[model samples]
Target: MAERVYPKLIGARLRGQTSYRASFALQCVSSGLGQLVELGVILILFGRVTSLGGFSVTEVVLMYAIAGVGFGLADMVAGQLDELPAHIRTGTFDVVLMRPLGTLAQVMASDVHLRKIGRIVASLVALVWALAHNDIAWSPATALLVVLAPLSGAVIFSSIWVVANAVCFWLVEGQELANAVTYGSGSFTSYPATVYGPWLRRFFAFVVPGSFVAYYPGLALLGRPDPLGGPALLGWVSPLVAVATAAVAGLVWRFAVRHYRGTGS
Candidate 1:
């Protein structure tokens, strides 16, 4: 069963992506170049300014590593961010629904973006360099958290991705709105939330839930305190947030699939 499903998923992606090799290559280059530019901007900031909001340049590099790995893994495993609406509009969802597997599983497993592997490799290398350059007091427990952070972060981002795609069942335009939460959350979390104002930090903690993924745990990892002096326990909440987000996203996905089948879209 695993053999069958794995190849089916991989083959689907190869066939789909073969039609636009030039576009796919361009997107990979664009993503890498964009990250390089952002890194350059950070270097410029750190060249003049010492640190921003208690986060050193190295610390921010760690945060970027965490965020990049999280976002990259999510996009690689689940690249159907824009496919749900297209499936609905074209009635391709019927084919998914007809599959013996769960509709959500089928939809999610249908495509894998191989270009994201470049991003993942790049982030991993940056993370290693950042770890070597920074002042991290690694013990048994801290080491565990460092490893778990990316796993939790990946799950959290994938949950956001699932929610984004599921919104397509309601309306095509909903996908755009969902980007505010999914992609915007990633962009915001890439920087230390402490750099943001009070209301923005609270929004990340309470509303969007991106704070738990990296910013808080990153503070703990870096042996720093939150400038707002928020609860230190927020760092430990990463796994809980990941599990909860996945559960909620799973329920939302189920409902969306049901709605799609019932409404014939």
Candidate 2:
């Protein structure tokens, strides 16, 4: 039942967004431009320095591209989970719970921002440019990593979104906290992990595991060694990291839902 219902729900939302073609187009353009400004910052920084955290401009851009694509897709799909707090505060979550559909699925399907595809498109362009500029050692494994990196990265990011936002079950005001983790991770993952201090690197790399989203995979694609002394195989483990993160997120979400006692309004 969910298999059939989920697609229809998403399709309905997609159609609704497209119904106002001009507004949708403008939104997409604005989103794309906004993302480009961030990319421009990276480029501008490289103009002065030869490298950041030991990575060349092209290499850093690859990290940005991978993270951007993953985050753009995750944001489009699961970013609406941020509204969980608002729903709880206003008691709309009770209606959500009463629905036949699963609470998480319904929340995810509630808002599909197709405008965020602009970011994905811009990231793909950057990916192409980065690929053209880099000296990658092409192989079947490398080719496969290129394809799976963004997908696995998306899963990793979406799981973080779910896990972080689940705090709303206990702290209704936790939206800001969740945003800090979700958006902060996106920004952090867009650069070399080596750029961060030792303690901070370990936190984002192991605690949040943002390194798997782009940094390690970018290393694999570029055929570069981990400067921080991680094993070469870590780059290929993004899918594994994604699966593990998603499992943990599922457990957290279930626990949070079970703990919910409603707003009592």
Candidate 3:
């Protein structure tokens, strides 16, 4: 028999979630409301301070938007990483592996939370509002670069989740560590990266690659020169960090599958 993974599984999950219209609608509204509170915080912060680490209120809002959209997309589509331990403990993981489809694909597509669409829409509105306040000089090149920022943010965050979940093949405690990277990084990135000290900022940028997703691409889009004196090439390369992280994540996922030890075996 011939079988492929990912698409079928994702379709299955999407259909299952959409089946409950009332629950899904409530989820969407709740997610939107939650993001509204985040926007309110930004407004309060800006009210108190003129700028954050040289990031204008608009740039700070852009960071929030990029991080928000990325997080909402990841949670909606790939948030199943949260349930790995329970699956393993219950021996349900065996059923997933029994399928001809890839184990990671099946696990990832196990759930799709559609309410994130509301959050994503909210992020876009925030981004647009930021642009209106601090209009950047428009060029075709910069325009496309700005657009890619959020996409890169999404990929980076998803990759972090992948690595975090991969550790579950060894440790049940992997879940907590994973949250620090996924949730912590998302919360941290929502602010201006420059607000952190030099070492911390560099770690997020070059080490973890969070900087590429929000800060660097933001600079390109907002027409702000790089504070680190990064060359012009860095602007174009911001989006590529997401692709690179995703590629590395694929390798990590393969390793986790290879290292799999059957539950209670």
Candidate 1 clash total?
Answer: 0
Lowest lDDT block of 10, candidate 1 = 256-265
Ranking by TM-score: 2, 3, 1
Question: Where's the lowest-lDDT run of ten residues in candidate 3?
Answer: 1-10
Better of 2 and 3 by TM-score: 2
Which parts of model 3 are misplaced by more than 4 Å?
1-8
lDDT per residue (tens digit) for residues 36-127 in model 3 = 78989988988999988887788889878877888788877678788987787677888887877777767777777777888888888888
Local error of candidate 1 at 80, Å? 1.4
Error of 1 at 180 (Å): 2.1
- lDDT per model vs. reference: 0.80, 0.94, 0.79
lDDT of 1 at 14: 72
Candidate that would win on TM-score: 2
lDDT of 1: 0.80
lDDT of 2 by residue, 1-265 (tens): 9899999999999999999999999999888888899999999999899999999999999999999999999999998998999999899999988978888889999999899999999999999899899999989998899889999999999999999999999999999999999999999999999999999899999999899999999999998899999999999999999999999999999999888999887
Provide the clash count, candidate 2.
0
* Candidate 1, 1-265: lDDT as tens digits: 7558868777877778766989877767776666666667778899999997778899898888888888888877776766777788878888877767777777767787877766777777778888898888899877888888888988998998888778878876577777777888878878888788889888877777888778888888888777878788877679888999999999999887776643454
What lDDT would candidate 3 get against the real structure? Answer: 0.79
